[model samples]
Target: MDIVNYTLKEYFDQKKSPCLSFNVFALDKEHEEDEQKWHRSDYFQVLLLQEGEVSQGIEHRNFDLLKHQISVVFPHQINALQMGDNAKGIVIQFDEVLFCSDLLKNELISYNNDLMHKLNHVALDEETFAKINHYGVQIFELFQSLSPIKKEQIRFYIKIMLLEIIEAAHQNYQGFRAPDELDYFARFKTLIEANFKSKRTVSYYKDQLQITSKKLNEICKNKTGQTALNIIHERILTEIKRLLIFSGKNHKEIAYELGFDSPSALNKFVYAKLKETPSELKQELSKIYKY
Candidate 1:
């Protein structure tokens, strides 16, 4: 099985110009299916589906996006898209370097830090959709032109578009009150991603976040309906499943890579959590995805 790894340079017409890093294009039947397969990218993407329905899989979750809906895919998330024959949409891919500015980075972090899982595909009202579409077109047009200050103009428009989407997302949940400690939860997730391979203890996260284990568990339960330890386990399981489906590494190799002391340790963990051994789970996935 072949995995599509879309690096930043490969995605932007094989150009390494950071200033001219973004690309906007339409999704039509002529689009290559290989580009739509399970792939990971090094940049952020915002895709607005305008004409028809499509299905997308992000990690372990799958979603259906309809007309006037937009989906945001963050860096390193495994994703695959299936577009209908009549599907028409605009996709904007921007290099992560664009968000290196402190102001822009903070703004995006604040808005995305607490977004619920179900809010990835945001459905906009007709008027709101039109407004967003207008900016998207302007940005794409500026991207195509060689006018002086075109990069600056594109950056300005992208910021405006992001602000509009953030506002819309906030409005989607009426009177949504963000928790004061949501940042802790966000940081906890970040830490999990960074340390889940070697640090599986909730107390480790608590120590790193400078919060008590009880408080951490409370926050995790409130935000994700899982205890802190459960969240860690789930993250680990998600990565394990991804590797199982996407990589040719055998169980023992995966076990060592994932920090399991031995194959039996990995098998025990898998069987205890999923009621299936690693080999059994891989077989099931192969039958489904033909990997």
Candidate 2:
């Protein structure tokens, strides 16, 4: 299956935020059939099966998700859903900002983290099922309230539920492991994600991370098989592709949003990095999901 990545913003815009800022979808087999090809989401999402069978193929690995079992799909993975005849579930999609604390957000965004290890292909036992059911009921009640006046309250409840789910996952999967130790190059990666939009130069990131440019490049190349600058530019380029394809921003607007000094500079970056014009990239991505 071909996999295209989508970020949190893209996910919400594509799917209506039903039930307030959070959306709970009780998908049936017909809807699942209408969902075409394997795609990956950028948002932090959780799927809770209330009835029937829930299964998925993520990056070639298959999952047999029983009732009450939850699956967490992290960003940048190809996922295919196969729901059984009686399949039903509550899928909650929300921005990580809903639970954004300095600590929790950091942990979530830390690329080399084990959050998914615990969440991926997780099964809820009978005891766990009771707890998930309780939260599920609470979510339905909040959704029915339909009061924009309580947006903050809704966000709080959603965050609490997700954290509880994450903690529960951790408990079940005692063998969960942290992502492999980030090397010096990956250290530079962390800094890049932390400060990509404002500080563009290698020197800025290197200085902030207290690593020399040469060492940073060497470590990055070793860890990811790409140069530090290439890695940074690729991330920026990926975001650019997303904005162009998913949004209707004009060239100048996109240039500024991406931290480019001038439209010409943005043009140059697109040409050099992608070997295509900005318009071409946009058209390409549009074609990618024409179905």
Candidate 3:
């Protein structure tokens, strides 16, 4: 079973102009049918459910979103949506490069960390839901227009939406405050993203961050409820899963690509973390998407 990988342009029906970094669509029957299959995209996605309910699966987790709820899916996360007949919403997708000048990478990392233990959906109050609906409509309209500054306008609207979600998360998690070691942890996360494929050692990450291994583990445990070693292992596991499902490569090839010494080593790692062999996991996922 091969996982569907959607690039921004391919997902938006703008393949002729692959340079476009963003797209917006209404959650109608047409869009719903197109998105019913399990797939992963190279861009960030936000789905605003205004009317009916939606059940979405991201990675191995399932999220049921009620009316007036919003769900954010990060890049490369496996996703599929099941919607009711009366579902009324808008889907917003954007490439990360569009926000490079906005310094949004760090903010997004922090925001994701805040939502780590919660469902990806944010349940909005009536007033906040109405406000977000207004912005979603405006953004969709702008995306459909030929205005020269439409992209800029759309980016502005997205920033507004993100700010609102950040504020809401802050309010919902009032007991959680930014730890003093946030900067250190953020840097560590950034490094993990960049080097996880080639580097998987806590000591290597600690050396990169100029911290002792014990201190790094303490920071990770305090902030993320995981040790530094666990964080590294999880990152590696995520990449392995992504490749196993989406890369269409054989086990030997994947093991070599991920710097594993041998196929058996990769197999052992997968079984240890997921309690399933790679082939078994793939077969299970195939059954899921086959539905």
Candidate 4:
């Protein structure tokens, strides 16, 4: 399915999560180009490489994903299409709520939550592939056999697969975060998304969590090689840029959406963070993204 047009509700109806969906195809046997831009609202995706190669992107980084390797795409992140002469894989998609209906379970709150928030795209070997796929199929079969009430059972199956997914993703994934510091940064990021427009101060976030700014900065730096304020600046700047380039909203509207005091305030932040005027940034982004 071309998923960009799909909201969370559409996915819920089709896949019936707690759900698991899987399909394996050979690179040589079929050819179809997907034109629909795809992004998810509240689901996680893992594309397991089957053969040949495909160039894809996650959050703007291009990855040449290959056989037995995997890439995890988180909700709300832009998922670029796989394109090339030869491409093969099984793409798996699941909702965040697959683990439990409670939604407040500690497993969901602590490690599982932070792990999902970390967003790793890693490669795996054949044996590792077989291991995760075993759970993947288990969830798939359970989902296939489900009636309405059995969704709970399917959720448990997904919880099991999610554990396996975590193991598979972190086995040797390299990109960001030390294992110990991962949760703090992950939570900080989640909160940023939840509150970026209203809470731009380092102290605001630190106070919200009852931690000091120093501790937050340390965690963010260790995990992402960026300071907390830097991260905040980037997040706000990115949204401003997105609004400027992708939407027809004027500066006043953009400022209001971003919770800036005024258009002038937003423009100052834009110039301070990006070294360019808002209009110039829009022009540049437009030229680069002229698809």
Q: Write the per-residue lDDT of candidate 1 for residues 125-152, one digit (tens) a residue.
A: 9889889888888877776764547766
Per-prediction CA RMSD (Å): 13.2, 8.8, 12.1, 13.2
Candidate 4 residue-wise lDDT, 1-291, digit = tens: 334543444644576642122222233334234312544344556666666776766544666777666667664555565545666555556543332233323434444544653444667778877776665555556555555445445455555655666666655555645435335666677788778989999988887767888999887755444689988887787677667765789999999999999989988998898688898987766643332
Question: Between the candidate structures 2 and 3, which one is better when assessed by lDDT?
Answer: 3
Residue pairs with colliding backbones in model 2 are 185-220
* Per-residue alpha-carbon lDDT of candidate 3 for residues 6-61, written as tens digits (9 for 90 to 100): 77756436655434557888888887765788876767788889899898877667
- What is the descending TM-score order? 3, 1, 2, 4
| Reference-based TM-score of each model | 0.59, 0.58, 0.60, 0.50
Model 4: ten consecutive residues of lowest lDDT: 18-27
Q: Report the Cα lDDT for residue 12, model 1.
A: 41
Q: What is candidate 4's TM-score against the reference?
A: 0.50
lDDT over C-alpha atoms for residue 249 of model 3:
91
lDDT (0 to 1) per candidate: 0.73, 0.65, 0.73, 0.61
The residue-by-residue lDDT of candidate 2 on 96-186, one tens digit each, is: 3333343454565532345555676777787776777667666666766556544545556666776667767777776555544343443
Candidate achieving higher lDDT, 1 or 4: 1
